[model samples]
Target chain A: MNEYLENAKAQMRKGVLEYCILSVLSEGDAYVSDIIRRLKEAQMIVVEGTLYPLLMRQKNAGWLAYRWEESTQGPPRKYYAITDAGRQLLAELDTAWQDLGDSVIKIRQPEKTHSHEKRI
Target chain B: MKNVFNICINGIIFGIEEDAFKPLSDYLEPLKAYFSREKDGSEIVADIEARIAELFTERPGGAATAITIADVNAIISTLGTPAAIAGVDESANTEAQPCAPRRTARRLFRNPAERYISGVCGGIATWFGMSPAILRIALIVATFFIHWLPILYLVLWAVIPLAKTTAQKLEMYGKEVNITNIEQSVKDNSLDTGSPVQTFFRDVDSALGRFCRILLRIVVLVIGLKLIVAGLMLLVAFIVWTCLQDVLFRDVVKWDFLAYEEMLRHIISASSYQIFMICSVVFILLTVAACLFWGAQLIRPFKTGNRMTHILLAALWAGSAMGIVGISLREMRHFTNPNSMSETFTVPVTDTLHLQTVSANMKLSNNAVTGLYFDKSQQRFFGEPTLNICHSRNGQALLEIRRRALGRSKPDAFDKLAGIGYQVAINDTLLQLPDLFSVSPPDRWSFQEVHLFLYLPENTIVAMDEGVMAHMHSNAHSRTGQQEYLWRVTDKGPRKIK
Candidate 1:
């Protein structure tokens, strides 16, 4: 049961990881480290290395664009920003998220189902 | 202390401990392979490397301190496994089982970490899954029977590549190439926990390595100490020899009457002699400095200014050596063409001709110096001339004085030969020849030599003095301690008339 829960949690995180990254960049441009930091703060991702492929995949799909920014401490930083298509997709994802949350909440309310049956 | 290697990652350089590099490289290699199927995969790897570089730079000591294995482990944990990085659902912990030993074909590679010499025997042992000690012993035992085994081992040592990387090390033991195996091999510090004999050999190998390292250090220290002592002694000896040339050469040693400078001046031109002395002194000083520097380095290793100092020293040494060689070549020209001048003095026709040698009779403690001597009153260098006897064709008695010397040219040789001084006093039938001949100053030595040839009629009886025995040629042999010996000049040359 614990393995099943872990699998489900991993699957859920993997599904929404791209959405969370886009949402973070939709607010403003951020380099990879900053994005990783914010995502880690939100508990959206565990490892920083996991974010690179997702970012690359999103950029290849035209939802994210990146630019090289000079870094003071090390090599140049790759700053990612959401594109117009990414913003449009985030709006659609926002509605989908709300609808899914409502469905889940409605499915969770057994008391409402019992009260409806009592009224019947 | 662990060895540190300078590694460049994403254009930033860092010093990393030798053991830490294996894990770090193993983590990246699998990640690279996992991502290679995607477009811009190399770009993703580059980004990850850049991040790693940034993380390394962000450490407390920055890039100045060596990156240890703990630092590498922390980075690896932060980066997660390659599968997780590739968005795979599988957890790293679930897949952490040790790789099963597979019977794959193994490639031969020199196992440098477990080697006694070039790791050939260890490599062969690993190939056949046996203890390296067995193979090493076998090779040693076989070497006595087959002399060519060592040559073959050297050939194999040159041909085989070292198992430097984790993958090659795994391949050497025929382990399957997978993420688990690579990680295991990297983290496996205690490698090859095999049979008891193998473990024993492994323990012995490490112990021997430690022993050899200590022995090498002790050897270096001993050599350094010896060099320091030898260099200091040589320096002191050089100084003493240079400063007290007269006391060392004349009084205390009585080896040579001429001083060091005087002896050098006799062999080379005055200008070249000065240059030679300067060059010799500089060379000795530079050599001593080099010896001291290297000795100190060996005893207590420390960094100096830069490679420039070493280069400067080597340059000075080579320059001095070249100067010495150039002066020697220039001086060699003086002793090239040899010329001889002969002077003949006719002797009275007599059946009995007395020959005697007049000793220089200089006041001395003892006759320690041979062949060459110094005349105190004349202040000249004199050498003993050789005496030879032969029959004359004219049936007349004659004494011939042949002075030979070398110079740059034939005329120069003749001019140098003119410097040779020899005198023979003829009184009635007795000829008194000085045992020593003198070479005048300003001409240098140039291999000056003198030979006296006594030409006499057949059956002429000749008597030689005891002092002339040392100067006699090998053709004329006489027993020592004898006052005199009679020699008859016959048609068949001089025969000793006992």
Candidate 2:
């Protein structure tokens, strides 16, 4: 039963990772390390590898952008932010996520729509 | 060793190490490539990256942290696959400009490069959302390893590219496609030259640099060739000395003990040529030593700058070598002498008269044995020559031996025998043999009344040989210090001092 819930959560997490990353980028320029921290706190995505490839994929797709900002520690690091395309995708992903949660509940328990506080 | 693995993402290469970055980079590349292909998937990848970055910020800065592959796989699963993103984008892209610039989030800059290869160039391009080719080429040209520029170019070419996934693309131009390139490049934008003299010197400096490089290359080539030659010579000398040296020693002291003077005589005679041999040995040693010095010079130390120490060291090295050679000719001559003179000589058979030509040639024909005296009283091969002897392949007709003996022949003896008194006779003769021969007289003979009689092996023509006389005179005059002792009749000649 726990495995089943975890599997669903994992799938949901995948679809929503873009939204989560964009959310952090949406706040301000964040280094890879910092972004990882924020995502972990939100329990959005726990793996670190997914981020680099995902960042590359989005950069390729022209949804997110970056600039090189010199740091005092060493050479410059690439700071990231959400593009307009990124913002649009995040909105769609956010709505979809909410719909996904609501639809799952509506399907599993058709007669219970009274309140939002429901325990798994 | 924390072996750094070069990780290439979006066609850019980065030397990524620390277990954390390695797996992170490995996991990111393929996923990024997949996301870039799906239109809406770019957003998916970007979101996932942002989330990952958020996680990184959450970690306490420490060496023990390691990013595992499971962490990557889990995040990848959450980000959804390319096929799903494509399906969603396809269904959503019905209206005009349906892939609208999402206005939901805003940020100051784009962290476009994720575990990307040397982001120096890629970062510059992504900073302005420009194509990376020009930047990459510029970086390549400026790289200090200009000879290996092609290799580096290919690596960067393969590792870094325009952002591939939605996340990377957003990151690249993600900084609202800023006009960041106007000032942020590593290359200087303005050239300020106010002084003509400065410009002139700069030109001179560059020209001088070219000249020096050309000259240095030629010098290095010549030195390298010389070094090889010297090395080969050293090897040959050492091998010959090591292998044949035994034969030389054996042939001299053991096999044919009598030919010691004929061949080995030059080696161990009382006035043996150990000095010359010592000089030669030193020369060979210096050859090897010099070669090694040059061999060590070939290594390059610094990464970017010229090796100044190489030049100075080479100069001092060569100078010191010459100095060492100068000193060695005079001093280190005692080391490799092959000559072994008997501790003492007998005088009965080596009578005072025949001792001068013991190691000298006599005007005698083959099939004639010269008479040599050995003194049982003195126990030395003093005057004449040793009787029992062995000759080389060309058999000996006359034995030239070096023995110290007193003067037995009076100066008037040759006058009485030749019927010529106080008159020197000079007849030049050329004797055929290998190597040079020397003459020595007994310590007791009086030079003024000395007369030499060649009891040469009978049957040969005897002549007043000028070559022998001149050589003997030179030998006598050049003595270390005069004992003033009368020399025996020189086997060299019947040259009476005029």
Candidate 3:
């Protein structure tokens, strides 16, 4: 049961981590702060450190884009949002997620032959 | 408005505002317009946004309270494209978009952090993906202990800005697009309400404060380190000195205890005693000097501390050393002069004339022995001698003072009065003084060679003896010399007063 639970959590992570990040940005052209707060609220376990490195990796992989804005307090601020590539990849991930979910549900489902045996 | 949707994305739950939802639905209309033939664009946009709001509100911290555009994106992502959701794969349709820097999207980051003075050192190290060690070591070594380094840190802390706005700090990490922290992106790090002059003054004030703190910290650290090193060295020095105590002080005093006393006895002298006494005093003086030097080590780097405290400690050390020397000198005296009374030099040759001379008429300071006594008169074959003298034990020689006439007419009553009149007084013997009193030259009859004929008993002990040969030679010599000065000893011996 523990092994099955572990696999379930792993499958959830691969499908959800990127969607979760993009979901935060769909609010607006949000900065890193907005994303972390949203993720932290959802118990996403995303840290500022972990998030930035991942963001940088994704940006390199062409799933992200950014722009600069002048700020009064410090030097300048950068805001980020998903591009078409991010949207497309998120779509592909959604289908893959449904398929994985069905497969896992079928495995955990009670056997049809055992259903009649239990009813007696 | 009949349907209210709550969106929870990544567990962040917030309600989808109808006003915010309307704009997002309007923006996705263009994308849905491409699939208009296959799916109802308005219906698809509405259904996706409702699901997005539901998920936003489903998040843990009431994400339903405020809905951002990012919420709509998550729902769209879940549903896929209009073509994909309407039962068509998006394999070929999504290919035309190439990832590029977004000119339309604004980036948010933490202000160039200045809240922490040296945080620049820390922040830059973090931002550039560099280790703090490399920066810190290079700075310290390069600055040669810069007096202004701390000030620089303070100024940096006050002026550069802080990462209070989540957007600015993220900018330091160079991430802008797809940032989820829009609400945290509020508030520009620069003071929004203050005037230009006020901001300038604030910067200057913080800069000065930072400078002072850095300087003070460095100075305190340096001084503390110096004190610690000096204390360690002094501890080692003290240990070494204590170990060498026996060797250092063993031979400081040098005198044959018995020989000194024997010389003083037979010669009726105090010169040897003085020499021995001085040796002991010198020994004590050296020990005190050594101890003082050792004590100074207790307060190593004493020169750097408070002047008044240094002076006070120095005075205390000096006083203690002085006391030690004084006590030691006093104790040393006992080794030279001990107490015992038996061997007295008994004067017996009463029928014959016996005279003595003290080489140096040093004062007979020892009070143990009193004046010398001789009662019976001697029948001198020559002219009757007038003055009687003796040497005292404390080194001073004395003579019985007498009245005399310089000249007189032949055997007259006036001569009798001037010469021997009623001036003579009597005691157990003539009242005597130290032998130095007879340094006067006789007018015509010169003193001849000394005859050592005085018989003193063997068992007798005397502190001064000048009754025989020494007495005669000194008298003859005095009678012959230029009368300006007196008793001059030819050998290694003591001399006397004029």
Q: Give the number of the best model, judged by TM-score.
A: 1
Residue-level lDDT tens digits of model 1 in A5-26: 9878877888888889989998
lDDT of 1 at B459: 89
- The 10-residue segment of model 2 chain B with minimum total lDDT is B186-195
- Docking outcome class, model 2: incorrect
Local accuracy of candidate 3 as per-residue lDDT tens digits, A37-105: 787788664222335434654666777877776655333445787888888887777788788887886
lDDT of 2 by residue, A23-118 (tens): 888888777667878998887765454566567667778779988777663345677878999888878887988998889988887656644445
DockQ values for all predictions? 0.47, 0.04, 0.01
Model 3 clash number: 83
Please report, in order, the local distance difference test score of every candidate based on alpha carbons: 0.79, 0.44, 0.42
Name the candidate, 1 or 2, with the larger TM-score value: 1
TM-score of chain B of each: 0.67, 0.23, 0.20
Candidate 1 lDDT over B62-88, as tens digits, reads: 999999999998887887777567645
- Looking only at chain B, model 2 earns a TM-score of 0.23
Backbone Cα, N, C clashes tallied per candidate:
0, 117, 83
RMSD of each: 11.2, 23.9, 30.4
Give Cα distance to truth, residue A28, candidate 1, Å. Answer: 27
